[model samples]
Target: MAKQAVIYKTEAGEREILRRYEEILAGWPVPAGRHHVPTREGDTFVLVSGPEDAPPLVLLHGSGSNAAMWAGDVAAWARHFRVHAVDMIGEPGLSARSRPPLDSTAYADWLDDVLDHFGLDSAAFTGASLGGWLALDYAIRRPRRVDRLAVLCPGGVGRQKFGFLFKVALYRPFGAWGLRRSIKAVAGVDPGDTPEVADYLTLMFTHFQPRRDRLPVFSDEALRGLAMPVKVIVGARDAMFDSAETARRVENTVPHAEVTVLPDVAHSIIGQTQPIMDFLTR
Candidate 1:
């Protein structure tokens, strides 16, 4: 008999993953804050945080995604600091987009408003891909508001090298279809239900409303003038930002920035718990 490749995949596998995510989120225990933030400029949504007075660690997720992406890490983060996971305006998240045709400055300003609404003056930021770019943009425009930053496998500029599936996901919201596949790709779901993942996508996650993930809105003047302590981590296998040249391109622009490329990882490092925790504590 001929050897067979592991092309043995099916829609059933996706449905199974979806079922498990729902179960996991429902049963898994974690530190959670149930609160809604109302802002006049943009849409208001529930903001989840851990701890009341711990140093605020703000996390911004990329497009086609929401705060729930952190479902895998919230409970653990509570041990160290107050973790604030935000749903961006204009993106497919819990936050409603007040208006469209938004620009980079507008996006940054909106983020500032969210920070203000929560009474956060200074915070540590960790973003992934598009979220990473947003984090740097915020540090650049409002340096005084940020304490520290860590951007994981960010996207934007001509620097982002994307994979086939990634390019497709960014293209459509497929909703349930997208969610099921996303879980399969992002996490190492042992044989179990992922309720935590599914609820976040269907319930808390926003795509039905006016805002979807914020599209790139950077002006050279806006992105280039930042002078803040920022750390950028890229994966060696990151089809987007996969080379030293790619890292250097971003490094050369920021005045005070550190870039690290981990060999065995991919853009999914944002979900990889350990590095992010270590970076924040340091």
Candidate 2:
């Protein structure tokens, strides 16, 4: 028998992380419904919010995170669009641990199932980091199905940096303090997060094994083929990816793409609620 893929270090750790995840879901900030949609990959978890009549908008979170990352943005986004925050498979969420090959059509097929389940022929997409890569891959491979695309600090467009890995290695021996520093440095965010947010991040990284494979950068032809309205928001000081390169490429290849490079931001681009909504709605 094939050994089941284990995302958490131990069974107990998985349970605790899930317990905390559920706690966050309990206060999802809007009336929401949860679904475990079946797909070829495995059962995928989705947290649905907003009015049923609203236009469908799919939200994909970054690696080492889940749908819960949308807590602060959901309320506002829900008012405008029916939001389906997906827990990407193999991540730390309730999704299946079946990580298909990144260099294949498996993820696009998985998303096809997800959209089919939602009765959506197409939907607007917004993603961060790894999720951004997923959205871009899908948008490129299945352009007809993506009404619009907006990515924040997305991968695949920029060159993925490996220097953070060295920094992480250097800090691992320092214990929790080092972990916190690593998170701050890599995320390019200040260490002033609320206690709840800080605690949750610590819990996630402690147990979850993040994907180590490099993201496949999109070719210029693939990017130029994007027919849908595209918006790319990147941080100038991103530690994980070359944000400037991302901005330059997207701007040059997809001439119609609206790219924004925040001068002071890093990999973690927050407070984009209004901007993203405007792009999606406009």
Q: What are the lDDT figures for the candidates, one per model? A: 0.61, 0.91
Stretch of 10 with least lDDT, candidate 2? 1-10
Q: What does candidate 2's lDDT look like per residue over 155-211, in tens digits?
A: 998899999988889889998778878888888645576556666777888988888
In the order shown, the candidates' Cα RMSDs to the true structure are 10.0, 1.4
- In model 1, which regions exceed 4 Å deviation? 1-28, 97-99, 161-225, 240-245
TM-score of each: 0.68, 0.97
Q: What does candidate 1's lDDT look like per residue over 90-121, in tens digits?
A: 44444554443335376677777778878889
- TM-score leader: 2
